[model samples]
Target chain A: MNDAFILAGIRDVARKHVGWEGPIEPDMRLVEDLSLDSIKLLTLAIEVENRFQICLDPERDHELITVRDLVAAISHQISDTQKPEEENSHRDTEDTE
Target chain B: MNIASVGSALPPHFYDQETLLAALRANWTQRHHNVDRLEALHRNVLVGGRHLALPIEEYDNLKTWGDSNDAWTRVAQDVGETAILRALEKAGLGVDDVDALIFVTVTGVATPSIDARLMNRLHLPPRVKRMPIFGLGCVAGAAGIARAADYVRAYPDQVAVLLSVELCSLTLQRQDLSIPNLIASGLFGDGAAAAVVVGAERRADGPQVIDSRSIFYPDSEEVMGWDISESGFKIVLSAGVPEVVKHYLGRDVDAFLDDHGLSRSDIRSWVSHPGGPKVLTAMEEALELPDGALDVTWNSLRSVGNLSSTSVLMVLEDTMSDHRPEPGSLGLMLAMGPGFCSELVLLRW
Candidate 1:
C-alpha cells in the first residue's frame, strides 16, 4: 500500500482505540501525542501487520514512534521485495522485444 | 459488637497452582515474553490454588463485561447467601435479627447491587439499612467491620452483617499481558465471607467493638488502581505498593490504637487483610510484630489467596473460630486498599 493509505489506516485505528481526535501528521508520536496505552499500541501493531502483510517487531524497531517511522518501515520492505520482481520484468520485456 | 461468627463460601471449580501456572505460561507466550520472571513471582505468592466461577474452557467465551458481570452476580449470590446463612447459624441468630447489612465487592457491578439482591434473596427485614460499597478493593473487609462498628456504637441494640463476595477469577482478561494482570490473576481467588457484628447491648456471647478509624495517604492515588476496559477489569498494581504500606502502616496503627486509649501491646490478637506476600512482610516489618502475630493472616493468604474485600473477614472468622480472646482481651483489625487508605477497628473480648 502507499504511504497515505498506511497513515490513514493507522490514524483510524488510533482514533478507534485511544480516542485520538487530533490530526495525524508524519511527526506525531504514538505514546506522547496520541496517548495510546501499551495494550492499545500492541493492538495497533497487530492491526498494521494484518493489513499490510508485514511483521514489525516492537522491541527491535525502537524508532517506530511517528507515522514517518511506520511509512519508512513499510516502504523498505516493499522496495526490497520489488527489486527481484523489477529485474524479472525487465528480462521478460527484453526477451519479448 | 464483636465478630460473633464467620463463614466462607467458594465456588466448586478449583484450579491447582501448577495448572494455573501452566495456563498462564501459555497465555504469556502468546503475548511474546519469557515466563521466568512471572513464574518466580507466582512461586513467591504462596498461593496453592484458587476457585473459579467457570471452567478454563469457558473462560475464553466470556466476550463482554456483561457476561462476566452476570457470572459474578450468580456466584456472588450463591456464595454470599451460603456464607451469610452459615454465619447466622453459627451466631445462633436468624436473618431477621440483623438490623443493617453492609455488602462489599469489587469484582462486579449490579443495577440493584449485591446488597439489595441479598436482601431480597435472604428475606432480610425491609427496615434493615443497606450500604453497598464499591472501589474500596481489598480494604472493604476491615472497613466494613469499622462501618458496622460505627453503626452499632450509635444504636447499641442492633446487629449488623458484613458480606464480602469477590469472584476475582471471573474478571480474568485473556488478551491483556501486562505484568500486573498476570500477577493479579494468580494472586486473587474467588470466595465469600460474612461476619455478624452484634452491638454491645445486644451481644449475647461475643466480644464488643470499641472503636474504629480510617487513614488516607495524600498524593498516592496511582499506587494501586483498576483499569476497567473492554476485556475486563485490568489491574494497575504499581510496584510501590509494598513501600507505601511500609511507610504508613505503623503510624496508622499507633494513631488508631491511641484514639481508643490503647496501644499495640494491649491487643492480644490481630486480624489483618492478606493483600499478598510483600504487603504482609511490609506490615510485619513496619509494626515489628512478633513472629506468629500474622499466622492466621499468612495461612488465609496461602489457603484462599487474596479474596480482595473478603480476605480480612475470612482471617477474622478463622481467628474467632480457633482462637477466641479472653473476656478482657483486645483485638485489632486492619486493612488497606486502592485509595492507599487504611481502616482499623478495635474490639474488646
Candidate 2:
C-alpha cells in the first residue's frame, strides 16, 4: 500500500513534467524510459520530498536507479520510520483496555 | 572590441544588508529551527544590499513561476533598453548601424527571446541578425563579448551589440532549504548590461577585439548547476566551487595568456565576473593579482551582489568609466558559469 502511494507520487510528477503517457512501473528508467534529464530528476526529487516529507540525498542513494527503485526506497524509509509509532499506538490501546 | 560604455539600472526597491539579513534569518527560522550558522554564512558573503523588483512580503503571493517570469520580462525590457541606448550613444552609433544583436540571460525563457523583443522595441533594422544564447549563466557577459567578436571577425565591417539582462531574483525557490539556495538568495540581484562591439575595419568607435578562449573543465559538472523545480529554479551551488576555482584558474589563466603571446604580468586591467565573495577571493588568490586589481569587481558585488550574466558586464562598465585602459594596452575579461567553464577575452585598447 505504501509502495502504491509512493509510486503514485512519482508518476504524478513524471507525468506533469515529462508527459509520460504509459503506466509507471518499478523497472521504468527515469532518464532513459521517461526521458527525464538531470534537471527533471532534481525536480522529481524535490516533489517527492515535499509530498512524502522525506529527505533524499542524490549522491548517496544508489538503489534509486529506476522509478520503481525510488518508490521502493521511499516506501521502506517511511515504513521504517513509522514502525515505532505503530508500536507505541498499540501499547496505548493495551493500557486503555 | 573594448567596452565603449556600460549602463546599469536597478529596480527602485532596495534594502540594506542588515535588513535583508534580518528578513532572511526570519525566513530561515520559519522553515527550520536554530539557523544561526546560516545567518553567519549570509553575513560572510560581504554583500551590503540589493535591489528587488517587488517587496519581500509580495514574494509569497507570486502564485506561479510564469508570473515571476513575466515580471522579469517587464523589468528586463526596461533596463535592457536603457543600457543598450546608453552604450550605443557612448559609441556614437545608432540602432540602424548595428548589424547583429546578441542577448544573453539564464533567469527566464521567452518565445521571441529578449533579443527579438528588443529588436522590435528599439526599431532595429529588419535584417539585423539575432543570436540569443541561454544556459551560459554568469559567464554569458564575457562569452557574449567573445561571440560578438567572432561575428565581427567574420564580417569585419559590421557592428554587434551584446545585451545581458539577469533578473535572478525571480528564480528564487521559496521552499528550498539548501545552503546553496540560501546563499544564492543573498548573493544574486537584478540588473541589465549592454556592450557595443565594432569590428576593427568598421568606422565606429571602441577597443579592438584581440582574442578570446573558452575552457571547459572535465568531470566538474557538479560544481554548479540549475535544478528547475516546481518551486522555481533551485540553485545547485556546490561548496567545492571556490576550491574548483583555486585549483584550476591559475593554470587556466596561464594557458589563456600563453596563447595570446602575453603573461599575466603584461595585462594592465582585469575585468572578472564578481560571482560572490568566496568566488572573488578564490580568483584573487589564484591569480595573485596586485592590490586594487579587483576593486571594480568587489565594488560591483557589494552594490549589486552577483547579477549572474550581467555581473561581469557591470565590472567592465566600471573599468571603462574609471580606468579607461590606455591605447595599445592589454586587458583581460574573464567569467565562469554552469558548465564549470571559463571564458576569457583578451582585449587591446
Per residue, candidate 1 scores C-alpha lDDT tens digits across B1-349 of: 6667887888888888888898778877664443554576687789988888788778777888888998888889999999999999999999899999999989999979888999999999999999999899988998988888888878888889999999998887868765567778889999999988877777556666777888888887877878878766888776666777788888888887887777788888888999899889998999988889999999988877899989898888888778777888888888999888888888777
Q: Which ten residues in a row have the lowest lDDT in candidate 1 chain A?
A: A37-46
DockQ, all candidates in order: 0.04, 0.04
Candidate 1 wrongly placed segments (more than 4 Å): A1-97
Q: Count the clashes in each prediction.
A: 0, 1
* Model 2 Cα lDDT, one tens digit per residue, B284-311: 9999999988999999888878899898
Candidate 1 C-alpha lDDT tens digits along A35-91: 654544655565555556565654545677777887788677667767899999999
| Candidate whose lDDT is highest | 1
TM-scores for all candidates: the values are: 0.78, 0.77
Scoring only the A-chain of each prediction against the true A-chain gives TM-scores of: 0.71, 0.74
In terms of docking quality, model 1 is incorrect
Cα deviation of A19, candidate 2, in Å: 28
| lDDT for position B291 in model 2 | 93
Candidate 2 scores an fnat of 0.00
Candidate 2's chain A scores what TM-score?
A: 0.74
